[model samples]
Target: MDLPRSFTIRESGHRIHNPFTSEKLATLGRALGLAPGTSVLDLACGSGEMLCTWARDHRVTGTGVDISTEFLTAAHARATELGVTDRVAFRHGDATGHVADEPVGVAACLGATWIGDGAAGTVELLRRSLAPGGIMLIGEPYWRREPRDQATVEGCYATTKDDYRPLPELLELFGRLGCGVVEMVLADQDSWDRYVAAQWLNTRRWLDAHPDDEMADEMREDLATGPVRHVRYQREYLGWGVFALMNR
Candidate 1:
């Protein structure tokens, strides 16, 4: 009932978890065009940043579901800190099959689409939570172009590329899934740097604290090489965005 320790301890001192910075998230929120008091559901809502912000900015109500007790605990603390606890709720459980208690004006699965296999499958699963004509928001990665080698692709992965798709095909896949792209906010190099580079700092902090831990060595190696690989391969060749969609 917990996310990996590595994830739980990432810097919340800044109050963000995703690659898209607060400014970028504001752009995303504007792109979604959520009205005040809109009901939103976010699956795999890491630390509940998006939901909390939406509640604060757009005055929306949301429910964020995640399997990580660690994250949920953080999320609740964040909600309290933001003074949006009354406007939003968080549930600690599996997001893949968990349905919302009520239909929502917006349904989202951000950065954790594997909860339903892939982008298209995740959209299908998220649709059940949406009210008629409600939008679906999916945050996922796409290849800027095809990878040139396995190392290039492996850099895309932490250790190996588990699932990857090219940009155009990803858009088409969503269209074929009975969706019309309403709007999207793509992540740029700065955003990518924010997401990947922040992990290095976290790993460094962890390695310092747990010098004798078995996994420390692996994390150290990952922290050491991750940025080099990301800058060289993944940053230039990969793209990610949160796409807003409507029923076709």
Candidate 2:
């Protein structure tokens, strides 16, 4: 609830809610080897960028689910703009236990892997939405290096010692879950900057419009310190990637 609203006000202007931009999306598209027609199921599909774009470009058809009414409304507008509203649709609902009515070739649970308890649980949940031999698109974060200090972790919003794992451990975790890492597209600092920095501009815009709104103070505080904290902590110590996995 808090996250969905934060996202709507923060990055709704972004064409893609994902970490990677057009470049990384291209890599993911290529890796998926999508044909002229491929179905996709996107869970935690904030704003529905992936489903809308894929439906337009690859002739895919599927459903998107998320908890945010605002996000679904925006997603619907995106679909209408892309002129693919007939093929793809968006629903406002919790993603933790929701599955597609029918199996799809691609079952995606992007950065919002916390949908099903956490990343590990989300992966298993996404699998259930895919048809046999279908792929699971998992977008998750990994540590660039094992964080040695709590300050670094806290800046990235982690307060626990087990919040994240290094790259090697992350890769192994997928393996232990019985998925073969078929392909992956990682996010560089440039991409992270795009994701985080863009938030500043959006937040500023929101604050401008809602100067007298109840959340103005919180927004102003976030705008003031977001960049500094991101640069000092998240950008340095954390790394993220969208991994394409298949059941082996």
Clashing pairs in 1: none
Q: What is candidate 2's lDDT per residue for 37-105, written digit by digit as tens?
A: 678899988888888888887888889988877777889999999999998988777888888888889
Measured against the true structure, the TM-scores of the candidates, in listed sequence, are 0.93, 0.95
What C-alpha lDDT, on a 0 to 100 scale, does residue 98 get in candidate 1? Answer: 70
Give lDDT tens digits, candidate 1, residues 76-145.
9888988999999998888987778789999999889889988878998888888999999999988887
lDDT of 1: 0.83
In candidate 2, list every pair of residues with a backbone clash: none
- At residue 34, give the lDDT of candidate 1: 79
